[model samples]
Each structure stands twice: as C-alpha cells, then as structure tokens.
Target: IDPGHGAQDAGAIGNGLLEKNINLEVALKLQSRLHQAGALTVMSRTSDTFDSLQTRVSKGAQASADIFISIHANANDNSGANGTETYYDTTYAAAHSVKLAQQVQPRMVSALGTKDRGVKTAGFYVIKYSRMPSILLETGFVTNPIDASILKSTAAKDRLASGIATGVSNYFDVK
Candidate 1:
C-alpha cells in the first residue's frame, strides 16, 4: 500500500487538514484490516517520512506485491469540486487495473456518501510504472468544506479503509 506524499511534501492542505496525514491514517487502518483478512500487507511508508515516487514503486516491485493501491485525498483549485474518484493506468495492466478501480470506486462512494466521481484513466507515476494491477484513489477533496469535515472524522476514515480492504479482498477472491 502507498499513501501518497509525506514529510516536506504535505500534499494538499486545506480546511485545516493535510492530505498526506489523512492518506496515512486511512492506509494504516487498511493495513490492519488486510492483515486480519489474511493478506500479507506491506506499506510504502508507515510513518511521517518522505519517499519518492520511484522509491514507492520500487518497494512494491521489490516485494513482488500482487497489486498496488495508492491512497490519496484529493485537492482542487476549485473548492467546489468534491467527491471520490479512482484511477487506473492503461499503460500496463489495463484490464486488471480497471477491474480494481471498478471494484474500489463504488465502495468508496458508498462508504463516504460523497459525489460519485467514478473511475477514470490516468497515468499517475505510481500506478503507471508499477508492474501490477494498480489504482490511485482520490478519496474526497480536502479543499471542499463538506469533504474536509468528513475527512476529519475517525469514523469516516475507518469507513474508507473498510471499503478499500473489502474491495481488495473481493478482487482477490479471498472470501
């Protein structure tokens, strides 16, 4: 699992919340959930440290992870843009990545009850370069007031983690 941004790179800060922190919080929760579900989970970063995008991909590659999930909160110059979106890169495992996104996207929308921005195609470095089924999730926008409030809640973060872990389990047919 990769939680985008850290340390000096605070990602998107808005409405008194940092995207990196939120991403890490949700990822840590996801790690526990996946571990309980019998998956050997590996994190790109477990603490408030910095890792380059290349390093992030390398970690997953070195581990030979079956799939990659890069978790991130969204931000926009337009604060009105609020919702959850999942992205997959077609340059590599097109069908697999899209399938992963298809499974993950609705779960996130349902979990957060945010706007359904739906799954999209994007060439984000982590997802694109990783040689496994990969997805980058935009889990609501910190720049938006409503999303910021929801992101601030532990319950909301738990819900998001639950949704993602369930999605991964379902995808892998792990019961």
Candidate 2:
C-alpha cells in the first residue's frame, strides 16, 4: 500500500483538509483490513514521511508485491470537478492493472456516493514503472464541497477502506 504524499509534500489541499493526511489515514485503514483478511501487505511509508516515486516503486519490487495500490485524494481548480476515479498504466501489467482498477473504481463510488469518473489510463510514475499490477485511486475531489464532506467523515473513511479491501479481495477471488 502506498499513501500518495506526506510531510513536506502535503499533496492537494482544499477545504482545510490535507490530502496527505487523508491518504495516510485511508491507507492505514485499508492495511488493517487487508491484514485481517490474511494478506501480506507492504507500505511505502507507515508514518508522516516522504519517499520519492522511484523509492516507492523499489519498495514494492523488493517486497515482490503481487499488486500495488496507491491511495490519494484529488483536487481541482474548479471545485465542481468532483468524483472518484482509478488510474492504471499500460507500460506494465496493463491488463491486470485495468482489472484491478475496474474492481476498485465502482466500489469507491458506491462507498462514498460520489460521482463515478470511471477508470482511466495514465502514465503516473509509480503505476507506470511498477512491474506488478498497479493502480492509483483518486478517492474523491477534496475541492468539492459534497465530496469533501464525505471524505471528512470518519464513518465514510471506514466504508471507503472496506470498499477498497473488498475490491482487492474480488480481484484475487479471495474472501
């Protein structure tokens, strides 16, 4: 599991919520859930620390992770751009990455009741170079009032974490 940004890199900031903080919180929750389901997890950073993109990819490669999921909150100059989306890169593990993204995308929308921005292809540094199936989840747009409200709620975060965990289990056909 990789939380998007941290420490000096606060990621996107909006509505008084730091994307880094939310990313870490959701990542930790998802990690706990995955652990309960008997999945061995590796986190890029377990605390409020920063790691370069290459470092994150190296950690996953070193651990021989089956799948790499990076958690992040989105932001937009236009606050009206609000929704949940998942991204996958075609450079490596393309098909599996798409499948993993498809699994997580709707679960996020269902969990958060946000607009479904759908799964997309992107060349993000982490997902692009990782040899394993990889996905980056834009949980919601923090700049939007509705989405921000949902993201700021503790109960919603738990549901979002559960939704993501379920998606991973579905991808592996595991309980």
Candidate 3:
C-alpha cells in the first residue's frame, strides 16, 4: 500500500485537513483490514515521511507486490468538484489495472457517500511505472464542504477502508 505524500509534501490541503495525513490514516486502517483478511501488506511509509515517486515504485517492485494501491484525497480550484475516483495507467498491467479500479471505485463511493466520479485513465508516475496492476484512489475532494465533512469522520474512514479492502479481496477473488 502507498500513501501518496507526507512530511514536507503535504499534498492537497483544504478545510484544515492534510491529504497526507488522511491518506496515511486510511492506509493504516487498510493495512490492518488486509492483515485480518490473511493478506500480507507492505506500506511505503508507516509515518509522516516522504518518498519520491521512484522510491514508491521501487518499493512495490522490491516487494514483488501483486498489485499496487496508492491512497490519496483530491482537491480542485473549483471547490464544487467533489467525488470519488480511481485512476489506472495504460503503461503496464492495463487490463488488470482497470479491473482493479472497477472493483475499487464504487466501493469508495459507497463507503464515503461521495459522488461517483468513475474510473479514469491517467499516466501517474507510480501507477505507470509499477509494472503490476496499479491504481490511485482519489477518495474525495477535501476542498468541497460536503465531501470534506464525510472524509473527516472516523466512522466514514473506517467504512472507506473496509470498502477498499473488500474491493481488493474481490479483485483477487479472495474470500
């Protein structure tokens, strides 16, 4: 699991919330859930720390991870832009990446009660270079009031984590 940014790189900031922090919290919850589901997981960073995009890709490569999931929150100049979306790159594992996105996207919407921005194709560095089924989840737009409120809730975070974990399990056809 890869939490997008950290430390000096706070990523998107809005409504007094830091994207890095939210990403890490959700990732830690996801790690625990995956562990309970009998899957071994490796995190790019366990605490407030920064890793270059290349470093994150290397971690996934070194671990021989079956799939790479990068967790992040979104932000837009237009605060009205609010929803959950998943992105996949066509550079590698394109089909599997799309399948992974398909599994994950709706689950996030259900968990966060956010609008469905749907899955999309993007050439993000980590997902593009990972060489495995990879996806980047834009959990919600922190800049939007309604979305931010939902994202800031502990119960919602747990549900979002559970949703992501369940999606991953479904992707692998794991019980």
TM-score of each: 0.98, 0.98, 0.98
Model 3 residue runs over 4 Å out of place are none
Candidate 3's displacement at residue 91, Å, is 0.7
C-alpha local distance difference test of each model: 0.93, 0.95, 0.96
Model 3 worst lDDT window (10 residues): 166-175
Q: Which is the leading candidate under lDDT?
A: 3
Off by over 4 Å in 1: none
**What would the per-residue lDDT of candidate 1 be over residues 117-138, giving only the tens digit for each residue?**
9999988999999999999999
Q: Please give, for residues 50-156, the per-residue lDDT of candidate 2 as tens digits.
A: 99999999999999999999999999999999999999999998989999998889998999999999999999999999999999999998899999999999999
In the order shown, the candidates' Cα RMSDs to the true structure are 1.3, 1.3, 1.2
**Candidates 1 and 3, the one with greater lDDT:** 3
